[model samples]
Target: MAFSPLLDELVESLRCLPGVGQKTAQRMAFHLLERGRSGGTRLSQALSNAMDGVRRCDNCQNFADSEICGICVKPERRNGTLCVVESPSDLLAIEQAGDYRGGYFVLMGHLSPIDGIGPEEIGIERLLSRVKSEGVSELILATNPTVEGEATAHYIADRLADREILITRLAHGIPVGGELGYVDGFTLTHAFRGRKPLTD
Candidate 1:
């Protein structure tokens, strides 16, 4: 069996999403065409609007409809601390965690030599400039715990070593509720290295 050309194209377009495979795309296309045409129209309109209007914030490199993101514009967020993350998703996760109240610099990606991404590609210079100009006292390297993420953090730290700011990396370890027996060796090592004393 074959779908009409337009329907097939819709299914193919949906397949471009991260986890939507052929069957999932087909199901979605059928659902939209069968009983969700209005919802699909709204979705299409929203996607078009976002694609056309959204751009990276000048200050943090996060997606924004204006020059700067909402987080960057908040006066209280400028608390002499800057958290560097690899993507907008990472920033959103931290925001959702509800503990951090400082500004952020989204790298958009980590340093990957094979992918040809370098310091300039990830806006390290802009990050450094922001640190210096904003009088940031604590620079938090909140990048992912991958090898490339570690390298990127180290690179940024080395670049800022001459400055007076205090730099720190996010601790990588087992989750609060995780069982030690189920934890991997790498995570165990990190947990041990980052362990803190419970008593003075």
Candidate 2:
């Protein structure tokens, strides 16, 4: 049986979400129409507000509502030690682990020359400027254990070769092909503590 035009539209729209297939989208549409009209309205409003207000941090490139992020403004964070992450989700996962007190620099994405993403695309120059002017003495590469992540780390390390600072990579407890957002807090904590220095 075919759905009404509006119902079909809703189902198709819901499929935009990841992992949401036809059946799931149909079910979601029904639920929103039947028992979640108010909730659906609120969710749409929230999505709109976030799209309008959210932007990247000028300093670290992390998602922020204001020009500077809270982490950058907080004075208690360790300014000399910087943790670099691929995305804000990775940064969130590390923060949830709760032992890291150093500042962070989010890449938002890694180096993918095939896909045309280069150093300027991910704002590596902005990061280097921060290191030179912000007194960052140590940088921790907390990118995922993927090929792109490894390449990005090496590229950043090479760029900073002229700068006088120590560099480290997260420990190996994290399995290959793993993303920081999917790792549990305990594993992330262990990895953070056992981080190894990258001299080359």
Candidate 3:
């Protein structure tokens, strides 16, 4: 029995998502098919809409419909504190915690020379400019607890030494080598509350 070209293409395309394998993609495709056209159409619409409208926020690099994300544009969040994160999802996690009331600088990724990702690739220069221009009073390095995240935080801290801003990192509650996006809201809030300054 041969799978139809449509199903094969669907499975292949779906497999492109992170952590999704061929079996999962096939199951999802079948589920959508079984659920009928409404489900499929809704899924397709959601995918297309998100892909088409989602763009990096000009201020914080978070996903946004406009040039700046809601967080960046918020009047209350215009304070001089900036939370630096590796991804938009991490930013969302922190937002969900409802602990941070300042702005953010989304790195988009960490420094990975072996994988060809570098400071510029992760928008470090842009972040530096934002730090300076935005009158940032403090920089909170909210990257994950991985080696790459540590390296990135260290690099940014070193580079920003000339600036007269306080630099802090999330507290130890996030767990070693754990990703910020997966951490629960309560833990994330606790981490933010108990954040420690990153000293030399």
CA shift at 6, candidate 1, in angstroms? 1.9
Candidates ranked by TM-score: 1, 2, 3
Residue 129 miss distance in model 3 (angstroms) = 1.3
Q: Which stretches of candidate 3 lie over 4 Å from their true place?
A: 1-3, 173-200
lDDT (C-alpha, whole model) for all candidates = 0.95, 0.90, 0.89
Q: Count the backbone clashes (under 3 Å) in each candidate.
A: 0, 0, 0
Question: Model 1 scores what on Cα lDDT?
Answer: 0.95
> Per-residue lDDT of 19-117 in model 2, one digit per residue for the tens?
999999989988999999999999999988999999999888999999999898898775599999999999999999999998999999999999999
Q: How much RMSD separates candidate 1 from the native structure? A: 1.3
Task: List pairs with backbone clashes in candidate 1.
Answer: none
Query: Between 1 and 2, whose TM-score is larger?
Result: 1
